[model samples]
Target: MKPLHARYPFMAGAREAVQEASVDLAEVVATDEDVVERALERVEWALTDGTVGDTRRQTRVELLSYPVARVIVSTVDEHICTRKYAQAEAASAHERFVEELETETELRSTRQQHLSLDALLAEFDLGTAVRETGDGFRVTVGTYLELAADQWGDEWRLVNRSLVDGEVPVDREELYVLLKQAIRHRVVDGLPLSVPDVIAENLDEEVERVRETLSNMDLTTEIDTVVPDLFPPCMKHLLDQVQKGEHLAHHSRFAIAAFLTNIGMTTDEIVQLFEVNPGFGEEMTRYQVDHIRGDTSPTQYSAPACATMQSYGDCVNKDDICEDEINESHPMSYYEHRVEEADDDELTDWREGAGEDGDDDSDESPD
Candidate 1:
């Protein structure tokens, strides 16, 4: 396998490279310990860290592990796992490509290994759909609509963009953002592969390990109810912003969505709460929410850290609990601390007054 294949295993060229090698996947799974271990790490790290972990020095091992990892995820046959694995691969590729573009140099130690921006665009059949402009690049409106998700933030909304002659213009950074979506689309395409019986039998132990880890990470049953009273100050601020029908940037939306999901709010409940937002699309919102909660995919997301919230300017209305050094490190921990200290009467469910009439003074969603 080539170095580029190792760096970007999702690219079409990499797929061709693998095919040409004619590697025996079954034998590799059974005998090649390094390939198997790397494959397992790919799934585990994707599940836990949203990364594919470090790039191995061995190009061959790294390239081979991509397919093996796919087999393992497919064997698990869990939608959430498949989604998480695919997204993690794409996210990792994006980071590397961004670095390469910024520095205008190869990220790999091997010379002439990194792909150029033009190469990347062509590999994905985007050459015709995207074109360069004086300020930056413009993507055909149809392609833009296909790749951009409104839930990504208000910025990705078509109305917020500069449209000219059936094309939408984007700066270098914005184009990369779109590329990330494309990469994700490519990685997720044809996932949960129909693994041969031989390969499946050989990977039983590795599959079991991943399944066990997935079981521990399941969030659906972990949170039973949403308690706004116990929410961290930052989360409270975010929830309040959403309730007011204000626009949240992508990170802010993710922060709030993840916080709510982890706190036990159902997808429908979150959707109802967000209904007040202008241009609300129920289908899109629910899919994004379900994706975050690992309902439709294998990647469950937790709320960002205290530092991340502050970085995005979403951290607001800090309270005494937030000032506590030990208790305020993470939003989840803050909520847990409040829950531990609150009396039964002090802990009220947010759903209590969320009735059809919406008569309650509290911030409740109407039926």
Candidate 2:
């Protein structure tokens, strides 16, 4: 969104030059209109009276034409000079002249600002090029005949040959009318026209075809119909579940049907609810019904397979032991159990003898 002046510095100066030139031209034209008129009259009188020699007469005519021409020429020259200065002011600016020219050309072409066929003919003295072939006529500009001959071979030959040989001759007025009709057909119906008769007939046919198509189209037909009551209750419920952020392993359609069946949802009511709920669609509800009932019907499961645990034991471990606790009376019991049974008996005998000796000494001293 940068301004054109900011992006292209040269354009800024060019624009300023254009404005100055325009103002200068306006002032000159306003003040000197009578002078220009007088000059023109003088040149005209010279031409009529033969008062001057041929060279002087030509010079007078050139002088008379100079004012108007100079306005245009000087403005353009100033614009160019300003643009060069602007470019020098911002040498690092991106190269945009070519791109701008191309964009401008495209816009002008699309807006039909380019010279019309008739205008080109008048301005360039270029005639319409055409050719003859067995199929139809091919018409193009004189300069484009070679390039257009391929795709429009038959039509080109027919039109060109007819025009050249004066077989289907046409005057300027007739040609204009025919050209307008052809252009209209090409623009509106995408139909190519080679001859005037063909153009008229094809245009009519294309119009009729379009009318027929429009008449046949039915806008009221239901392209996407939904049946709510037919959807299983579980499927509808699954829609709610999914909406609530619960994940499902299998297709929700089967799950929804199963859930509905489990909750005693009738086929008719399930379908009705499905129809009423904006969240659930008929296809999803159908899928749920198929999934829950082990229904292998074509309508049951449309999604790919998913993994799920069928029972709690399927995912539980029965052999796991608690290693963080030890018996209070036998902290080393676990380690002792790892010892040989014979070694354990010898350790117990030694502890018992030590307990008997301590008990005897305590009994004698207390008495």
Off by over 4 Å in 2: 1-239, 242-253, 275-279, 294-367
Q: For model 1, where is the 10-residue window of minimal lDDT?
A: 358-367
lDDT of 2: 0.32
Clash numbers, per candidate:
3, 31
lDDT of 2 by residue, 261-319 (tens): 33334344345445545455667665555444346454322211111211311111211
Using lDDT as the measure, which candidate wins?
1
Q: How much lDDT does each candidate structure score?
A: 0.80, 0.32
By TM-score, the best candidate is 1
